[model samples]
Target: MDAFSEFIRGITRDNPILGLVLGLCPALAVTTSVENAIGMSVATAFVLVCSNVFISTLRKQIPSAVRLPIFIIIIATFVSIIRMVMEAYVPSMHAALGIFIPLIVVNCIIIGRAEAYASKNNVFFSFVDALGIAAGFLLVLVLIGGIREILGTGQIVAFGYTLLSLPINPAVTTMIMPPGAFLTIGIIMAVVNYQRAKKRAKGG
Candidate 1:
């Protein structure tokens, strides 16, 4: 429950995507490029952090019978704000993300945290939890996007900048397709599971 442990858990043990396997819709859809992954992650983080804090602050006043609706309302408000800001400043990415942006209102990670953590914790702890989970979300999305972009296009491009290019010619185009997302996530999950199993065997 300490801040540091909670934060680290989000990135490692409790990762929203890799660990908990939540929020896969956008994780698979907008992760074709690192830039899009970053954009979506940041937007989700904003909404999550804002809603977490707001819900935590009013937990005492919210009725249990109506908490779910209240959580959605709070989450939707922040989602709208971030959507407008992105549309105004980063129109291309905004369009790239498309329906997934509005769909953040229903993202399980955010809604789950609001009910399971934010509603039961103090504002500070809720904020910490949100930050941890958001960081984890960002990390996994970026990893998936980087792998896809590099394999699919043989290069990494972000916001008009080419970060890295591989010597491979005619990249595996399929890597950028839907199946590629599934393959990349599946491999990563397998590797993670293997590592965890190894640790368990050694009594760690």
Candidate 2:
């Protein structure tokens, strides 16, 4: 397999959120700002890469009938590690993300990739696939978060760095709220679909 292609595919062609529409709960729940998005992204990425390696390394030994349970165990183990590290060092981010960190244990993105690709693939390819999907998730989370933070608060701050600010009232605080997540995702999906349609029409 072309390793780079496999990696890039997750960032674009098969984005878990934009293309596959998976794992919306945490995507919306914690994406109130770029910092939160990045926090969740890193946690998920760590779990994905570690789990991919752990599972792929044992693919041959894991019995098919009981593979799913094994995968969950491995994934949960890594998730627990992540929780501890976050709680110890980045407690603010850990507190901000809260249960969502544990929620990563059952995230469809993690399990689905573990089952569909990591289980059947070699260790290198599985690692690349997991990283690719994690990158895709990070990209979308940051984009949506940037929008919500800027519009909802009339400014955007990431990791204590101010990226942008407006001297006027916020556009709509609801954009950072639950309902706004659906609206933002809906608009983004619409734009993505439109671009796809245009590409198809141009025979590209």
Candidate 3:
């Protein structure tokens, strides 16, 4: 496939969350607020992109029997670097994200791409694929986070700014909980499925 098509496929047809259903743990865990969601997405993106490039570059040299271990090492190194950077610069976000930052090493999205795409593809396309998949992840996380934040707290606040607020507080704190994450993702999946079905019917 061409680079553009590959990139678009990651965002749409193969999205880790809304499409392929990968990486739900962090998706559901850190999306209570938009700020936390953004932080997680950025950290995950850094690891995904860096690991993809490194793995693709070393794919030929790495033995197939031990490729997975090498992939983990590469992923962990990037995750640790980002973790320390976040700790030093954005300590609050770093603390809020907590274990999830380190957990990115095992995130299916990263390992899956390393094995499935990066290991097989050239460096440039691997980079493109990571960017596309990361964008898709960010898209879903922010959508869920924004919905929960607005409904649960009657407003949306990120980076010390109120992007949205409702008159006469209508906060429903339940929307910030685990059940709310399930409900929000369920509704989103339904909508996505409906749209895809409609497009198929229209012969798109």
Give the candidate number with the greatest TM-score.
1
Question: Mind giving the per-residue lDDT tens digits that candidate 3 earns over 55-172?
Answer: 9999899999999999999999999999999999999999998899999988999999999999999999999999999999999999999999999999999999999998636578
Pick by lDDT: which candidate is best?
1
Ranking of all candidate structures by their TM-score, best first: 1, 2, 3
lDDT by residue (73-98, candidate 1, tens digit) is 99999999999998999898899999
Give me the runs in candidate 1 sitting further than 4 Å from their true place: none
| Residue 74 CA displacement from its true place in model 2, Å | 0.7
Model 1 per-residue lDDT at 100: 96
Between candidates 2 and 3, name the one with more favorable lDDT: 3
- Worst lDDT 10-window in candidate 3: 165-174
Question: In the order shown, what is each candidate's alpha-carbon RMSD?
Answer: 0.9, 1.1, 1.2
Measured with C-alpha atoms, the lDDT of residue 27 in candidate 1 is 96
lDDT digits (tens) for residues 22-91 of candidate 2: 8899999999999999999999999999999889999999999999999999999999999999999999
Ranking, lDDT, top scorer first:
1, 3, 2
